[model samples]
Target chain A: MNSSSSGNVGIVIVSHSPKIAEGAADMVRQMVGNAVPLAWTGGDIDGGLGTNVAGILEAIETAWSPAGVAVLVDLGGAETNSEMAVEMLPEDRRARVVVCNAPVVEGAVIAATESSGGSPLAAVKRSAEEFYA
Target chain B: MHDAHASRPGETPVPLTASAVLVNKVGLHARPSIKLTQCAKGFTAKIELALAADGPWTDAKSPVKVMRVKAPQGATLHFRVAGPDGKAALAAVLALVHDGFGEV
Candidate 1:
């Protein structure tokens, strides 16, 4: 929500419902404070590509570049969409992305919020490790 | 059968075996803990976490019991099931833990 942090990795949360994406981001903000960059793809973003493979690719091109991005998504469309995005990512950059398994909103928030101070890849790995542990 | 066992009353009884793995990440957060406790509530079993030998094992069926434990990543937990379906229940839980609650 806050665009002030310039160098941090961009985290995108996708859900069928915009409200849910907001809720997930909000939870993360509450825990670590608003010091990370966040964007939403599924909720209110124009074009159906927000949660789709194209949308993820666009977000990567637009936001991740110098710093890679991490994505957390809800169930249903969000899940399949993340998987598709993974397939589309270039093999070299694939390591930069991660899909969390926190169970919809909870997982997204945990992944996005925890993605600060460390490498975006590390944050995402930690989230995945925690969720699966 | 009763007479045979009674003849050896002084002998120690064999302990029952049960095992469960740590399923939830973040080491058993409230939501998953509640879910596990609710599942344990259905039947009567002496459920307890196999904490470090020095640490006391807590009841698995109690939400509070699970909350007290701060299990981290890759930690394997054990459950003591003793009831009608103790063996079956333990087996199911073992499978769930092995699967990492469907996440892994």
Candidate 2:
């Protein structure tokens, strides 16, 4: 993980399938390069299809930045697990992270793009959420 | 070049237009579309893109919208840019496409 005090917001991608999470992260890396911090998690602890709360927590830490971290989840389980992961954090750290209601892949890519351009956490979340709006 | 003269009050700004081919091997797929959107957002211009010279333009600054264009290799991309920085925006976008999105 880079410095959490960095100016750029970080991103976390969660999905039921590891491939989906990895592919989305790949697209983000390709477009944004190393401009923003990014991490992703998917599949259950046993390597089957599912979302793992512990893994989600680890990913959030891996991508942490004081600017903020936007978590994009693919399915309901992923979202719920991401929320649980957030709840597991300390009070102040919890506020810096948000689980975005968005289409996971697109949202992550857009969130990362905005973050790469040095947009704040709120702006990054807004741009990614605009897809639903 | 475009007519960049200031418009009279209540007059609509003259939009600058240009065309470029999608010369990259994959055209405007996910990666290219993301690059295009990121590039478009860097400017203050309101930019839109269409498959032809007229009609059905999509916001170029939206990655999803641009990806939906699903343009293939050899496809021509038409652009309409309107703003104080429209000319520069159009130039940058055109240059990106002309360079095959740095993939050619």
The C-alpha stretches of model 2 lying farther than 4 A from their native spots are A1-6, A17-19, A43-49, A129-133, B1-13
Per-residue lDDT for A1-133 in model 1, tens only? 5443656666777777767766776765654345567766664346433356676566555546346677777766777777788778889877777666656555554444434543456655465346546
Clashing pairs in 2: A4-A66
TM-score of chain A of each: 0.69, 0.94
Clashes of each: 1, 1
* Fnat scores for every prediction: 0.00, 0.37
DockQ of the candidate models in sequence? 0.02, 0.37
**Candidate 1 residues B1-104, lDDT tens each?**
75664355433233245555565566666545544554555545454566464336776655444655866656767565555556655666566566665555
TM-score of 1: 0.46
TM (B chain), model 2: 0.88
Which regions of candidate 1 deviate over 4 angstroms?
Answer: A1-8, A43-50, A61-67, A90-92, B1-104
